[model samples]
Target: MMWKTVLITIFAAGVLADDFSQITAVVTSQCTKNNAEDKVPEVEAALRTFGNCLKGLVDLNVLKTEIEEAKPNGALDEVFKKYCDKSAQLKGCISSVLQGVRPCVGNEYANHINDAQNSTNQLIDFVCYKDGDRIALFIAEGGPECFQQKTENLKTCFLNLKQSFPTVESANNLSLVEKCAKVDEMTSCIVKSLEECSTPTPANMAESLIKFMRKDSPCHTALPVSIV
Candidate 1:
């Protein structure tokens, strides 16, 4: 989930950096500055533990190779399931880290961090828990085209959306309603890409993406019932 957040942040702004290192620096800096210097080592260690846990579960190079070598027509349900089974442990690790840092950083920072993590967790739940088989099948059938060919377009769409605002900071500060408006455009763009790529754009897939945006977001009531 931390990786998801870091990747999204990078893709949204169209910048790349060492994600774990950036996260550790940001968190450790917070602790050191807020009259919590003594807690710095503890917080740093906890963050490293969580990061190591994630790295153990997800090897980017291996995952990429597996996905690339996966036969389009072959069964990949089991392959994805193997990773999904570790979700519980991943969640537990993050939960513990969050709890350990809360007292040092206070509620505001902890809650902000939690919200970001929750967004990634929601995505995992959607892909692996709520509708695992359907999602796995979608990947098996359309993954190559979407990931290999259209990934740039997807990234471009987000970067463009981010550019529409005055500044990156301003974009990040947008109200939930304003953000959901942009999300609507993003959803349409994605659906269009899927159609152009000859990938199946199931109604539920679009619906789920919208619903996922609404979850834990202040835009729950502002977003439409259907957009696809």
Candidate 2:
């Protein structure tokens, strides 16, 4: 039984390592591309720091889950407070890496910051300290983990559309639209409306759509969406 436990632990460790490696690869690519062709040391520093914080994220996520399960009095307050604290820490670390890095690296850090912003709210809400926290977290983190899966599907659908797209009329017939049928348009409209509200009414929905329609380029600027 002891040996079996050890093997199980090892297997779990391996899976975690693999997951981290993949995330690292994505970040590294983003950084290296954005930054100049030369600066590698800075990228390494960013990865190490990101990895460290990722460790803390894992712990904090677990801790929050535990608190939620225990349902201690005023536990929600504590959970949210810790979330705010950790989120600030994550932003600072990510900012440090972004500084002096190239554009590719900048993009990487930007995405991480965006993700961090989202995660911050989530931990807080899991404790139910904030109103609308439950609904926000529900769409963002709950519901069969559909957001992640759908995002992946959207990317894939876009790629295929780019590759062997059918006629323009049927372009919207992609796979993502189907599986997310129960949720797609509503979600997209919510984000788009929020984007519009961020700027003046003489806004550019076309530009908004283009920001996504086009490849993620250095020239394009899009409004930030909160994830946490």
Candidate 3:
């Protein structure tokens, strides 16, 4: 959730180009494929309502300005502290919108929407309330630079890592051991990249990630030690 927020903040701050249009295209493709053509308009309207609700929650112009001004250091934490204070209200708004739209969307679409909402809630709770201190420390210790400069590298590494595993319809199909191994592989890839990029403090970055995986992730049951 913090990562999504960070990417949005960076884009708002003019650090990245408009790749969101491409993302929108992909989402549109999926929507058309998954939902009945007749229900597409209803789905679009539901998404619009959700967007409008978000607009009412926070001033995008103000948020963009703040992010732009905050810049290279502490921006992520500062933005989170300032804006994520309203995370509870945001979550409530999300739930309310989804409830209104669930009846109109297909079951498959509804399930995906609910899953997205749950993931958002989890990330919000993790970064804004549960592990704020750890997140702040991670950001302070070269997390931003590593993310900013090595985003494509990290993305490529993750994609390649995923390729190593057998393709499955759902992650639930993977056993706990298999999931833990994937998590370990992904962490190792990230840690390796941070070190390769000469991030200001790769160890701290790795430690934070290790702690997160061990304490918060599905792999928690299996991951008891630092992967780095």
Against the reference, the lDDT scores of all candidates come to 0.62, 0.40, 0.58
TM-score of each: 0.67, 0.39, 0.62
**Candidate 2 residue lDDT tens string, 1-228:** 112222222322333353556544544564455555455555545556655655765575586575565354534444544555555565564444434233343442444444333343343333333533332333323322343434554465345433443453343464533423312333343344333332322123223333333223222223233211
Ten contiguous residues minimizing lDDT sum, candidate 3 = 8-17
After TM-score superposition, the amount by which residue 169's alpha carbon in candidate 1 deviates from its true location, in angstroms, is: 7.1
lDDT of 1: 0.62
- Sort by TM-score, best first: 1, 3, 2
Model 3: residue 192 alpha-carbon error in angstroms? 3.1
Tens digit per residue, CA lDDT, model 1, 1-228: 223345334422221234556655665676666678678677666666665667778776887667556646465666677778888886776666665565455544555667766765776777786336756666766655565677777787677665666564676687767777876676667666656666564434655665775655655676654445
Name every residue pair that clashes in candidate 3.
none
**Number of the candidate with higher TM-score, 1 or 3:** 1
Off by over 4 Å in 3: 1-28, 59-61, 67-80, 94-116, 130-142, 165-174, 196-217, 222-226
